[model samples]
Target: MLDASSNRINGSIPLKMGEQGNLNYLNLSNNVMSGIIPNDITLLPNLRLLDLSSNSFHGAVPVTKYSFSPLEIIDLSRNYLNGGIPVEICFIVTLTTLDLSNNSIGGQIPYCLDNLIKLTSLNLAYNNLNGQIPLSLVSLLEMNLLNNSLVAQVPDKYRYCFPAKAFVGNKKLCGNIKGLRHCDLPFFSIIMPLVPMSICIGASLFLYSKRFDQIEGPGIQLLCAFLPR
Candidate 1:
């Protein structure tokens, strides 16, 4: 258990520290560290809480190649990390709070993140993420996704659970949500259903008119032939 957070630690993380397999809690956040996060740090067997946020760390997140099974809280926000979030982070079933906000991360949010049943707080605000917000994230107690490149309709399940601020700064997002515009029905979806019904009605009308003409034609011809002669 080591807590060296909030200090102006100005250097790269020592590579040898990753050999500490028995470390339980490590917090080196709020410092000025730079360089790629060492992959060995993920090898810590008993690590529960890992916070390296508010730093100058760059490159991809450290957990892309390894699994952090025992981790519960992960705060890597306010860094310069880029690239799509690795799907392996979702493999941590014990994760509760995940913060990757205020970075340059891109790509669509992975649907596999919904597997974190214990997740309660999620923050992906101020990034370059795109695509539709996954419906599975509605179960979270707290979420912040403001200022991103997300588009399309907000899932119906999330309309009432999350406030508009959580979804603000996205220009293209729309739904039945309170703060956003209503989602427009696609042109084909609106027109397709009416087409079949219109064809049926038109066929019924044409057959009815033909039957009426057949019934009246004989009577009119007989009346004219008998009276005019």
Candidate 2:
């Protein structure tokens, strides 16, 4: 297997490497690379391993039909990549290990993750992703989703595997997770108190005005009768 991980390589990956279809394992992780990843790397036919994690790559990851197939391990974590994970990446049937933690990517986790029956380890921690944790990952041996803006109830199975600390620092997230706080229902504060108080004030003012009019009405009449008219 081609293991170039932790090599401290810098600069963008050259597009010329795409022609090497025979290469099965590619690892450039723990490097200083920056700029957009060259899309041409997807052309490798026999590529089974890809590691470009722990770098400075930015922008969307290029996805083609070949991006997912024949790949058992892929890591893009600890980088500056943004944008949602492409839908094609989740449907890759052969993907066994995937790490995409520590990024700025947002949007809900794609529903296609259920199709990845072979996925054993998945890491999507430290991002801006929101929405519920998909139940498909219940069978995963290991899954990390820490530090996201997720806002739905997590499945009991997943909560059992991953504690609340795995999902901390997300103020908007909720559920029975250990470290998370409960999300208050919308309008619970204002609608419950302010509305009732306003109605009570209005009713009290109406009744007082009616009583005052009744009391004043007879007095004025009596005074008018007593006056020389």
Off by over 4 Å in 1: 188-229
Off by over 4 Å in 2: 66-68, 183-229
Best by lDDT: 1
Instruction: Give the per-residue lDDT of model 2 (tens digit) for 25-55.
Output: 8899988998887766655777777889899
How much lDDT does candidate 1 score?
A: 0.80
- Give the Å error, residue 35, model 1: 1.1
lDDT of 2: 0.73
- As a whole number from 0 to 100, the lDDT of residue 14 in candidate 2 is 83
lDDT of 1 by residue, 11-115 (tens): 998998788988989899999998888877776889888889999999887785477648899898999999988898888889999999998999999899998
Model 1 clash count equals 0
What TM-score fits each model?
0.80, 0.75
